[model samples]
Structures are given as C-alpha cells and as structure tokens.
Target: MMTQNLLVELLVEELPPKSLKQLGDSFARLLAASLEMQGLMSKDAPVTAFATPRRLAVHIGNVAAQAADKAVTQKLMPVKVGLDAQGQATPPLLKKLASLGADASVVPQLKRALDGKTETLFWDSIATGISLTDGVQKALQEAITQLPIPKVMTYQLADGWQSVNFVRPVHALAALHGADIVSVNILGLQAGRETQGHRFAAKINPIVLHNADSYAQQLSTEGAVIAGFAERRAEITRQLTSAAAQEQLTLIDDDALLDEVTALVEHPNVLVGTFGAAFLQVPQECLILTMKANQKYFPLLDAQGKLANKFLLVSNIRPIDSAQVIAGNERVVRSRLADAKFFFDQDRKKTLASRVPELNRVVYHNKLGTLGERSKRVLTIAKAIGLELGGEALANQADQAANLAKADLLTEMVGEFPELQGIMGNYYARHDGFSEPIAQAIEDHYKPRFAGDALPRNPVGVCVALADKLETLVGLFGIQQMPTGDKDPFALRRHALGVIRILIEKELRLSLDMLLKQAKDAFAAQLIKENDFIFDLKIFIFDRLDSISREQGYRPQEIEAVLSFLPPYLIQVPRRLEAVRAFSDLPEAASLAAAYKRIHNILEKDMKKGPMPGVGSVRNLFIDIHFLMEPAEILLFNALNTIKPQADEAFEAGQYTQSLQLLAALKEPVDAFFDSVMVYTDDANLRANRLNLLTLLRDAMNRVADLSKLAVN
Candidate 1:
C-alpha cells in the first residue's frame, strides 16, 4: 500500500527539434494516464515533463507500488437458461463458471439478479491487484506505442541482430520509484537508475539519479544540463534579452524559432554573431528569412523595426572564451547572406513582365493547366472585380498587378524561398518602373495568407486578392478536387476563409453571387464544364463564414437564422446577426417567434395540400379586404399595412436593428390572429385570405432573419 514519486527517462540520439516538446508531453501524459486507468495512481497526481536534445523524462507524484484489489460483479446468463427443472447447474452455467476460473462447486454460492426483463445469475469475486513491476511495464509499453512520432527509424540493438523502430535510437532507459529501480524494459534497453546527459558538457559521464525527487537536480548539477524544456527556454530568453539590452537592439520575437532552438540544445549558450552590413542592402524579408530558416538564428531589429547586422545563436556548449563560436556562426551566416544577395541581384536583371512567359513551363496542377493559364484567369477576374469596385482606373491597376503577381514565382530569389513569392514581386515590379499602387498591389495580393493575417491594404490589392482566391476556389471545385476532412492539399479552407474575411472585414459592397459568377466565367475559355460547383462553392464559403461567426461568439441558432436567407451582400451579414440578437432580447420576441413558427407550418401544410376547390391557386393567393371577415384577421391585415412601410424604409436605409425592432409592435395582433382565426377554415375564401395575410406577415418578419428558427420549442 506504500506510495512514492516515480521518474522515467528515455536516453536516445538527438530528437527532431520541431516535435520534441510534443513527444515529451505525450510520453508523460500517456504514461500517467495508463497508471491512473489501472488504479495505481490518482487522476490528480502531479506530473512534470522534461525534454532535452538527448532525452525525454517524466516525474509522476504519489504513484502506488500496487493497485488495490477490487470487488467485481458479472452477469452470467438468464436464470431459465442456467437452471433446470430440479434447480441444479446446467451445462451452459458450468461452462461459463469454468471460463471465469470457477466450478460447479461454487454454484450454491452464486446469486440471482434481474437484468433487463430476465432474471440472470451473477458472479461476485475479488480481482487481484497489479504490482508496480507489471503496471509500469504495461504503462511504459503503452506510452511507447502511442507516441506521435513524426518519422520512425529502424536500427539494430546492441546485439547487432534484433532491430527496433523509434524516433531515435534508444541507448538507455531509466525508471525509479523513490530510491528503488523499477523493473521495466523498452526498445531492448533495461530500466536503470543511471542516464547519460549533455554528451560533452556533463560534469559526470553518467548521472546516477539518487531518487525520483533528485532526478532534475542531479541532471542540472552533475550532468551540466537543464533537463526541463520550459526552464531551458526561459534561460535562453533571459540571456538573449540581457545581451540585446547591452547592445540596445530588440530581439525579434518568434515563438516557433525559440522552441526549435530550445530543442536543439541541452545546455543553451546564447552568443552574439553578425553578418556584413552590406547584406542589409537586400530586402530585410529575404535576409531575415535566410537567417531564421536556413541558419536557425534570431535576427535582431533596430528601433525603427529594421533588421540589424547582429543575430543570436544558441549553442549547446559553453566555453571560457566564446569568440570561436561567434566567429564560426558569423562565417556560416555570411555565406547564406551572400547567396540571398546574389539571388536578389540576379532576379532584378529581368523585369517581372519579362518573366511572365516562363510561368507557362511551371506546372501548377496537371489537371488545372500551368501557372501561365492560371495567371490569365486571375487577371480576368481581378479586372472585372476592380471595375465593379472602382470603375476603369482601378480595373487597369488591378489588371497590371494581377498579371505580374505570379511572375516572381519564376525569379531566382522566389525560387530559392517560395515564401517570398509575392514579396519579391513587389521589389521587381518597382524596379521595373511600375507605379507604387501597382507594385504594392502585387505584394499585397497574397495578404491574409493565414488566419488572423492582415488583409490587402488598398483597393487595388483587395481586387487582386479576391480574384486570386476566387480563381483557386472555383477552378479547384470545378475539377471536383474539393477538400475532404483534414486533407486540404490546396488549402481551399484557407482560401475560402480569406475571401470571407476580405468581404466582411473590409465591408466591401460587392455581391457574393456576382463575385462567384465572375470567377466561374474566367474559366470559360479553359472549356471546363460546369455542374453545381458554383452552388457547392457558395456552400463551402458559407460554411467557412459559419465557423468564423461561431469563433466571433455568435450563437449557432443565430447564425443559422441569418445564413438561412443566403444574403447576397456578405457585408450585411454581421448587421443581420446583430439585428437578430437584439430582437431576441425584446419581451415580445418569444411570442412573435412562436407565432411565426405556427404561421410557417400552416402555410407549408396548405401549399403541400394544393389549392382548395374555389381558392384558385394557393401560390398566387393574395389577401382581399372583403375576404377578411373575422376581426382578428382584419386587425392583423391592418397591422401589416401600418407596419410594413416603416419596416421596409428602415431596412432599405440599412437600419437593420430598427427594422426588426419595428416588428415587435405586431406581437399582440399576431398572437390574437393565430389564437382566433383558423388558417384552414371551412370557408375556402376565408382560409385563402388568412393564409395570404400570414404570408405577408412572414415576409415582413424575415427581412432581417428567419424568426421561426428562433422558436425554442
């Protein structure tokens, strides 16, 4: 019944820096989960995860040496099937008892219980507890099997014959309970109290962890390593900050870069290194990217938010004199910077317009033609959108920008760093003597590339960006290459979200239906046959919109009500949602919503039943004042006449909240009409008139959103 803290470690070759944190966390989480599920530990036990370049470890608090025995009851079979006329054991009962390690001798002690509709025999027994040795073995194996390894490596063990698959070759396994070693094995390594650390910088060759609680302290002092991932990352941050402060330069903040660098070193030593200032002559984006991506260095920026000549490198070893480390890093970065400068210089020799023809040779998609054909389609869509947004002047600018947007894909710099495709195009377009708007548009056309990214800055950029996204969506959907589940190869979801953000956030007055139509028309020359793709594309975009709305904290019913109308101007959607939300708060909202539901159901039923004998056609039925005999029907008709104009005026003037609020005045008459008047009265004329009156009320109420959707019942 004794409990103590436990420590588990896996020593191996360097892990993948990008996924080290995930692997460590998963290993700790899965191990602790298995122990708790086996009743060997409480669910609330404290757990700590440690990850370095060479190891993954976890410490769990209050883990038991063995799980407590549990009493269990199990259903056997129906009493009729298990018993005979003489009230004795049957063959089926005896066989079931044997499978459970029991025999007919214990049948007299069995109990009977009602299960569902039948009386069944039940067996009760005490299940033996599992010892720590068996429990830890099972837990360790479960953790290893469920690890999210990015890539698996197959290597031979020490025997030179048996092989194992792992993220890296495992050299040692350590597991401790208090001061005692736990008997467990994985990847052909037996558990022990000793683990290797900081291959070169460790104060001791092999760290002998004294106990579960001493693992971290011993690794830090004797092993010369900071075993915890977060602690080491913080230390690196502290050093970087102090160093940058001394130089009066700000550290460029990139969490992903920081995590990767943290995973690349066990004993992180932050050192300052610099490249030649002349490299800054190239675009800062190109220089910064090369340093971060190729060199895994953090570039410092000056007060003006410009890249400085200095950069920071995280080294795994600390030496008395750091000059050698700094110089080596500087030498390596200079070569990378030189390559970037070369590409930038060579890319400028040819104009972006000159490179346009080369895109024909670059395959975009085999089914969708080359980048050249795609660019033409984009240019057409952009120009049309521009004309609609800003007349001929904007259209010409959009045309010029869209035509050169993809040209940079053929440039040397972009070829080396595809992340800089639109970026390099801006520089090339300016060097080609194009106007600032055109150049800027060429760059901004790929704006808002990811979630929460900025949108295009100017009208021309907006036109081009929308056109570019639309072409991708329509063309791909046309090819039936729509994204299914998590596999969005072309990132259609991102593109769709970009379009929705641009339209809604920018408050552009463009029509969604018109934009989709224009995008589809651009592909006409490609001779691509069309199906329900336009409709499907709309649904796709709307689905993205629904997700965005939900993230913005709108209720599902509220979103459904507004989207059900399929408003053409996406700019108006937020306003419509606001109106619906405001209307729901009104005291009359519930009654009116319920009345609308009733009215909708009545109209639906009548339409489905076809026309009455003397009713002419129900579809075209209109309320005639003479047909309004009942006072409730007359009162409702009079209310519509009085309220419709005011609501229509407010709606036309874009006062959506005011428009929906105006309908609140009709709740009394709507309730009275529904309570008194029978929509399907025996009198044919009266029934048709009442239905028409309800239909008119429905139209007025739904100008903002479908109120019936808000009906709770």
Candidate 2:
C-alpha cells in the first residue's frame, strides 16, 4: 500500500497555557502509536506536533491508507473437548467456531497441537486490514481519550441537545491524507480542511489548509499564526533577545514563562514597555515575579544583573503603530507594580518579630499544629545544629533567624504572593535592624527549593535550612502523613533530598540519625505517635540519597558497598563511594572481592551452625595465631596483622582511598587461604581460629566499604 502524510487538528477555545505543550505532544504520540500498532504506519514514521491557545494538531509522515492483512493463529478448546472420542465435532466446538464466523463445514481445517500437557485445537485465519477511515477514527478517539488534559469542561454541542467533555469547547476538526479529507468526526464536528486562526490578526477568517504537508505553511502565511508550539516559542525568544539587545539589557531567561507566553498568543509581537523608575526601588524579585506571573511579561536586567525599568510584553496583535500597545502594557504594569510597592511598604511597617504572633493562627498541618508551633520546633532544631556546626555565636543567629522565618506569612506582600514568604521576611528582617547574617538566613532557609538550586549562603543559613526541612519531614512522618507513591503533597522527597544535598555538599559533620532525633525531640512525645518512625524516616532519606548518588554517576554496586555500612555521617558517603570505585579498578580487586565474599559465606554458614567448641560465641570470637595449623592460614594471619593497622590509621585520618588501596596487598594471601585452607575443619580449634581470623579480616576491609558487595558471582 502507498503511504501519504496525515494531518489532524482540533480547533477549540483557549487551552490551558501550561498544559498545551504536553497535550499536543501526547496527542501526536498516542495517535501515532495507535496507527503503528494497527499496522497503518511504521513505528519510525516522522510525527510533528502543533499546539496553540486555540488548537492542538499533529502531522505524521508515511502513514498508510490501510493496514496490511495479518495472518492469525488463534487457540481453540482442547482436542478432548473440541472433538468427541469418535472424532466428531461436539456442540461446544460448533458454538466456538460459530462465534469466530465459522461452522462445522470448516471444523476439519482445524489443527491440533500440544498446549502445556493438553492437545489443543487451533484455528488459522487471515484477519482483514482496517481501512483509513476506520483506522483514523479509532486512532483519533484513542488520542483524545488518552490526552493529559489538566481538566475537562462539559459544554453543549452545536445541536444544543448533545454535550461533550473536552479540555475546551471544540469548534472545528480538520484532518487530511495528502489533499483528501480523512472524513473523521469527533465532538460533533466532521473533519474538514478549514480551521480558525488568530482571533483578530488572521488575513482570512477561516484558514483553508491545502494538504497534509501544507498545514503549517498555510497557517503561518494566511492565518497570521505560528502553529507549532516550539516554533512559536523560538520566534518569541528571538524577538525578546533582539528587543532586549536594542536597549542594552538582557531578558530574564525563564523557559516556563516563555512557554506560557507562547501559548497565550498565536501571533507573537515582542514589544518593550517601560515602568516608572519609582517601582525599581522595590525588590527586583517582587517586580519581576509580578510582571512574569501576573502579566506574562519578560523583565530585562542591566549589566549588573539588576532588573531594569523596561520590560518586554508579547502582544497577540502586531499593530503598525506600536506606541499604543507599549503604552497600554506600561499602564497595566504600572498598576501592578504600584500594588507590589504598596504591599512592600505596608509589610515593612511591622518588624518580622512583631508578625510572629500572627503565625499562630495559620495552620501548618492539622495534625502538625500551627505554623507558630512549627517555627518553634524549627528554631530548636536550628539552634542545636548551629551549636554543632559553629558554636554559640552561630546558634544565636540561627535561633533568631528561625524564630522570624515564618513571620512573613502574616505580611501583606506574602499574603498577596505566597512565593515571597521567605523573601519578604528577609526584607523585613533587615528593615528591623537585624544583623546581615540573620536577615540572609531568613531568606536562604528556603534555599534549594528545587533541584540544582543553590544551597544556603552561610553557616547560619545552612543551620536553618537543615532545621526547617528536618522539622517538616519529622513532623509529617510523626503524624503518619508520609508521602505515598508520587503523591507528595508536602514535598517530603524534596525535603529529604534537600537534607541529603546540604549534608553531602556542605561537608557537614552532622550525623543523620542525630539530626532526626533532634527534630523528633522538638515535637512533644504525645504528638508524635510513630515511635519507630525514625528508622523508617532514615530509610527514606537513604533511598533519596541513593537516587541522588546514582544520578551523580556512581555505579549501583559502588553505592551499595558504601551505603550498606550505613555510615553515621552522610558527609562520608561521597568519599566512601569514591574509595569503592577506585578500589574496584585495582588488579587484585576482583580476587580480593571474591575471596571476601567466600570468607563472608564461610563465616555466615559457621555462625548459623551455632557456636564452635573452642569459640564461645561467633560475636565474641578472637583470633589465636597458636591455633593456625595450615601454612595458608598462618600466612593470611600475618598479612592481616601487618596491613590492618596501616588501613586503620588511614581510615581514622579519613584517607578512604588509601585505606582501600592498602587492602589490595591481601589478595594473594586471601586467595591462597581460600584455596588451601578449610575454614570449617574437622578440628574444632582450627575451624574456630579460621572463622575468627576471617571475621577480623572482613571488619578491617569494610571500614571504608563492604568489599564483598563488589564481588561478581
């Protein structure tokens, strides 16, 4: 069958801007997958997705007009059931054949084969291929059904009697193969070649697509619309850059903002607008956020990376005289900036300390008590961490910062923009004459709000950040509201990862178990019902750490070897993993790892068999060189005596790599012992001595990491 490019489009009311890209991509992928599964298109066929505020579309190349016929072999009932003992077709077999559009006349053509232990009857037939009309209809319906729509709207169709649910009200449907209409109907609209374009700027009221391949070109030329989401986004980026260049400023690079703006307009015209200089006095984050979030404008920054007075707005209509558009945008932005300024000025009237009492009214979580209580807990944790990290002076600063961190929740600025909670607290802290370190800590406590985000700037900030995350994690876990699957409404995974990042990246010597204990201690005993949650919480944190380590390029075995030891301080994990990786590369590494694994197995088997005669208990076993009868055991014992101290000294000095490297000298002795010596000998003293020696060797070799974990079976 010959193939031609195919196009499908759904024109509707404005779609949710944030979801348009996903919706378009999913529609194309699902539709193409369905077609390919139906044999109507190759899996490698090229697919293009187009999405705008008013449309979602896809164009797939090399799609067939009809799927190829398939030869199918379907299993029937067992021969004993299908054929009577006399070899005549039974009533059940006749009924089964009838269901498959066959009858007794065709029963003789059935084949018998062994299925498991029973001889089963099979029917061979050719399944007819689906026509383009049926295939396209099914694929389109499947695409729409599987679309990742954020929400669905129920609306009446043109007939007013029938209703349909969609992301938005569908006004038109367009689909074509080459130059011919595909004749598929959806949402009470038949597929056609016409689709509406830009609401106000289209040269034609209804854009007439010429063919499957001409959809994008015609839409761009006549419809005054950039149909492809990425193409439109790129065009807007280019324009923003050019506009920003003319003013000698740089555009704030926010991909999310760009995508939202792209979806808002089919015909993007980037125009620069100026705000009053008075507005620049407000924090740039506040003003920039208002412009990007409230008005979908791009804020420009000066050479020093400070927000400038001028910003760029993407207008849907491109007017010949652009002064009015710029002025209209500027007027709207000035009003927004004025509101921000008023909030900022009003929020500054009260110190963060004064606003602290109001947080008592705001609930953090019903089970976790009010934000005020949470703040008190965080302060306790922060103070403890600070003392551990930097003594009394830093503890004072962290305590003060944590006390006032959530105060901004009551501020006018934060009330209007929750994203400004920590930010406004910082401003208020400084305004209240607090020290710079304290003010910075208030803001930086929420540092690393996302992946790859920067950590808190100073020691005070680190203490508070760690405290705040720990409080949230321990409190929620205490209340039995722990995150399940992907439903982390409180962002516990992020909090755990935040803790992991701070501990590992900041090289904090704080113990993970100690921190969890500190957090749990801050909460009242009666309020925390999960008595054993610390163990579960520790496991959760380690799981997140394992994921982070893997993402950072550590191999699974290397990670397991280090993490299996459950090193008290997370700060030691990276170095330990590094040591394990380095140790694995040594020539003796394989033999040593294998021998360590063998030693482990021998010790485990002996321990399971209960205490030996000479060894009172495996746990209390000690090496006795006097019991070393075999030369191999004696030689290994000598090797251990010599190397153990050196490795121990290096490990104590935190020279993990060097320590693991020192163990490389044991490979030959270990191999010889395993080959020539029997750990479980007939002589009880020899067996006890061997097991004790292996236990000592295992302990010494695993100070940095479990070497047996690296062993390959």
Candidate 3:
C-alpha cells in the first residue's frame, strides 16, 4: 500500500515548435497509461505534463513502488487428455505442468471445471509484481516510441560511434520515484537528476530537481523556464494583454499563434514594436499576413479592428531596456511589410478581368481541365442558380463574379501567399470599377471555407459559392476520386458541408438534388456516362448534413425520422426535425408512430409478395374510398379526411409544428381499427380495401416526416 510520486524528463536540443505541445502531451499520457495498465499506478493519479523548448517531462502522483501481485486462473486441456485412464498424470499432463513451472506433485491440486460439455483442468497461481525500476524503464521506452513527432534526427552520442534517432539530439534523461533516482535509460542517456534550463536566462546552468513535486517550481526559480504548456501559454497571454492595453491596442486573437509562440520560448517578455506607416496603404490582410507568417509577431488592431502600425513580439529574454529587441523586430518586420506593399501595387496594375486569359495555363486537376474551363462551368451553374434565386440583375452579377473568382490565382500576391486568392480578387475587381455586390461576391465565394465560418452576404455571392462547391464535388466524384476513410485529399467532405451550411443557414430555397444535377451537367462534356456518381455524391452531402444535425443536439430518433425521407428542401429540414421532436412529446405520439410502423410493414410485405390484381406498382399507392366496411374503419377514414386537409394547409403555410400536431387525433381511431379490423382477410375485396386504407393512413401521417422511424419506447 506504500506509494510515491514519480518524475521523468527528457532533455534535448530545441524541438520543432509546431509539434512540441503534441509530443509532450503524448509522452506523458502514453507513459502514465502504460503504468496504470500494468497496475503500477492507480486510476485517479494526478499527472502534470511539461514541455519547454528543450525538454519534455511529467510528474505522476501516487505511483506504487511495485505493482501488487495478482491471482490468475489458467484453463488447461480437457480432463481426458491431461490424465490417464487410472486418474494418474499422463506424459502430456506432466509436460504441460512442467512448462507452467509446476511439477507432478502439484497436479492433484488442479481444479476441474466444465467448459462446453467436457470437464477441463485449471491452474491457479500468483503473478509476481514488477519493481518500480523495471516498470519506469518500460514506460519510458514506450513513451519515447509513441511520441507524435513530425520528424526525427539521427545523431551520435558522446561515445561517438553509436547513433540514436529522436525528435532532437537527446542531452540527458531524469527519472525519480519520490526523492530516489530510478534506474532507467532512454535515447542512449542514463537517468539522473540533472536537466538544462533556459539557454541564457536561467540562474543555474544545470538545474537539479531534488523531488518529483518540485520539478515545476525549481525549473521556474533556478532555470527561468515555465515548463507546463498550458501554464506557459497563459503567462504569454497575460503579458500580451497587459502590453497591448498600455498602447491602447489589442492583439489579434489566434490560439494557434499563441501555442506556437509559447513552444518557441521558455520565459516570455512581450515587447511592443511598430512598422512604417506607409505600409498602411496596402490591404490590412496583406500587412497582417506578412507580419504574422513571415515574422512570428502578433499584429495589434485598432478599436475598429483595423490592423495598427504596432505589433507585439514575445522575446525569450527580459532585459533592463527592451529597446534593442523592439527595434530589431521592427527592422525585420519593415522589410516584410514593404515586400507586401510592392506585391499589392504590382498586382493592381493588371486588373482581375485582364488576368482571365492567364487562367488557362493554371491546371486545376489532372483529369479536370484548367481554371479557365472550370470557371466557365461555374459561370454556367452560377447563372442558372442566380436566375432561379432572382431574375436578371442577380444573374448578371453572379456571372461576372464567377468569371473572376479564380483570376487572382495569377496575381503576384496570391502566387506568393495562396491563402489570399479570393481576397485579392475582390480588391482587383473593385479597382476595375465593378459593382460593389459583384466585387464582394468574388471574395465571398469561398465564404464558408471552414466549419462555423460565415456564408455569402448577398444573393450573387450565394449563387457563386454554391456553384463553386458543387463543381468541385461533382468533378472530383466523376473521376472516381471520392474520399474513403480519413483520406480526403481534395477536401470533398468540407466542400459538401460548406454547401449544406450555406443552404440551411441562409435559408436559400434551393433543391440539393437540382444543384447536384446542375453540377453533373456542367461537367457533361467531361463525364463519361458510365462514371456518373451523382447519387453517391448526394448521399455524401446528406451524410455531412446528418453530422451537422447531431451537433445541433437533435435526438437520434428525431433526426432519423426527418432524414429518412431525404426531403428535397434541405433548408426546411431543421423545421421538420423540430416539429418531430415536439410531436414525440405528445401523449398520442407513441401510439400513432407504432400504428404507422405497422401499416408500413403491412404494405411493404404486400408489395414484396407481388402486385395485387388492381394494384399496378408501388407508385400507384392510392386508396379506394368505396371499401369502408367496418365502423372502426369508417371512423378512421372520416378522421383522416378531416385531419389530412387541415395538416396539408398548415404544412403548406410553413406551420410545421401545427401540421404534425393535427395528426394526434387519429391515434384513438387507429388503435381501434387495428384491434377490430383484419388487414389480411381471406376475401380479396376486403384485403384490397384494408391495404388501401392503410396506405391512406401512411400518407396522412407522413406529411412532415416519416413518423414510423420515431422511437416508441
């Protein structure tokens, strides 16, 4: 029952900043998980992971010096094969016992049990626990092997001949159980208490950790390093905010940039720097990108969210005066900003319209044609969409935008920074004196490039956005390059979700199937007839929609009921799902859903058997009103006639909840009919009449959704 806290550290050269956080987290989790699995640590042990530029370490609480011994029962062969006919040990039994480190004297101690009809022999033994030294060594090796390292480096140890592969050249390894150093070795380094701190700011050159729990504190005081990833990140954030507030500006909020900066330095000192005001003439995005991407500096923003001339730099060392650091950062960033300004000025000389011809040389895909041909197809789809959404005005604007959406790919700025493709197009479009909506549409075509991203602001933008996404999806699927598992090289799934999000959020009255068909037809000249994958493409989009619905917190049954029909109007799906959820709360909801399921099963079975004498096919799903024989059946028919029109009226008026609730009155009559009437009567006329009545029941119940898919219990 005795336990102690444990510590492990791997000191090395500076790691890849982008992957440092992941490497540290994975190392700690994998080590702790292995120890817990082997019963060396308890389930609730506290684990703290630390990652600096030069080290990865973990402190685990309440780890046992040795795993407790466990009692295990082993099942052996059947009794007949293990023992002779005289109930004495046979040669096979003796050999089996010997292999288990047991002898013939202990054979009588084995127990007999039934395993599938034959009696089997079982042996019970105590498994000895593993010592802390052996356990920590095994865990340390596993943690190193399982790090999420982006790349590895091969380097020679001090011995000068033997080489080891790791994320960086390992300098030292430390392992401690309580205050005692545990014997362990990894990456050609033996375990010890010595670890290096910050490259320059540390008070001590080689900091020695005396105890497991003192790792973080000692590193901060003696080594001048904030070891915990989250802790270091918080400290950087606090410093940035304080520094920004003093300048009456705000730092751009980017978590990824913060994490990378935290991983790059041990002790953060936020220093304010400024660039030349002449760069303000360039687009704010261009200046901001050059500052952040080219130089690892945080751009400051004014009250209106415009990029300010000031930027913040996170320095690893704190000096008496930060003037040198600030000035050096400003000098480096001034060059980057000037280059951006030059690209912007040079790109504006040639408008987006004049760049259209250059798109022909740009290959979009090997199978799909160049950007010019692709833009033409998008123009065709966009025009049709715009005309459907609005009349002539929007159509012209969408066509203009679609023609120039990708023209900026030829621009010098876009060629240098591919992320600014659509953005540069918008600016160029405006410089050419195009209308505001058309200019905006050029940039907004890629509006929902990511999840939860905004959709196009205007109808023209929506038309072009929809067309662009559809073209990509259909073109890629046409060539049988559909995504499988986690390999979506072309990001078809993101495109599909973008399309779905726009249609649903913008309330665009567009048919998903119609858009898919338009996309397919746009590629008609390129698509071979046998390779058309339109149906599969639609399924893929619906799959994305299903995921979105689940994330919106709808019940599985509610989503299943609404999506089962695969309604043509995806924008109205959320309303229908909400209605289904409300209906499920009604007292009559369960009975009605059960009866609907029964009716569906009955009709499905009838169709599968064969077409009836009068019934032609599944499409001819109509009920004859002449065969209402029983009182229960007549009541149900009358109820359906009364409620169907009312529900239809509400549904057409967009009162989805009211339309679904109108069917609750049918539950009583439906239950009565099922109890008193026989749907599969021997008489042909009676059976046909009952089938038609059930069909009528089904049609009335499914006005808003397929109610049968609702959960009854």
| Tens digit per residue, CA lDDT, model 3, 1-713 | 79999999999899999999999999899999999988999989999899988998999999999999999898878999999889898898889889988898988889999999999999988888988999988898888888888887899989999999899998999898999999889878889998888888899979988988888999999999999999999999999999999999988999888989999999999888988888899999888888778887999999998888998999999999889888888888888888898999999998888889988988888788888989999999999899989988888888999999999999899988898978888888889998889988999999799887888888999999999999999888888899999999999999999998889889988998899888778875635355548888888988888899999999888898998888898999999989999999999998889989999889889888886665323446555666668899989988988998998899999889999999898999999999999988776667777787788778888878999898475
Q: Which ten residues in a row have the lowest lDDT in candidate 3?
A: 614-623
Residues forming the 10-long window of minimal summed lDDT in candidate 1: 613-622
What total of clashing residue pairs does each candidate reach? 0, 0, 0
Query: For candidate 1, what is the TM-score?
Result: 0.96
lDDT of 1: 0.91
TM-score of each: 0.96, 0.97, 0.96
Task: Kindly list the per-residue Cα lDDT of model 2 for residues 1-713, writing each as its tens digit.
Answer: 99999999999999999998999899999999999989999888999999999999999999889999999999989999999988999999999999999889878899999999999999999998999889999998998888998899999998879999999999999999999999999989999999887888888879888899999988888889999999999999999999999999998889999989988999999998998998989998899989988999999999999989999999999888999989988899999999999999988887789878988998988877899999999999999999999999989989999999989889888888899878888888988999888988999999889999999999999999999999999988888888998899999999999999999899999989999999999998788975788989999999998999999899999999898878899999998989999999999999989888887888777767876587434677577767888888889899989999999999999999999999999988888888898766788777777778888998888889888889997
Among these predicted structures, which one has the highest TM-score?
2
Once superposed on the true structure, which residue ranges of model 3 sit more than 4 Å away at CA?
A: 75-105, 112-121, 611-626, 711-713
lDDT per model vs. reference: 0.91, 0.91, 0.89
Q: What is the lDDT of residue 460 in candidate 3?
A: 90
> Residue 292, candidate 1: how far off, in angstroms?
0.3
- Go through the candidates in order and give the C-alpha RMSD of each one to the true structure: 2.0, 1.7, 2.2
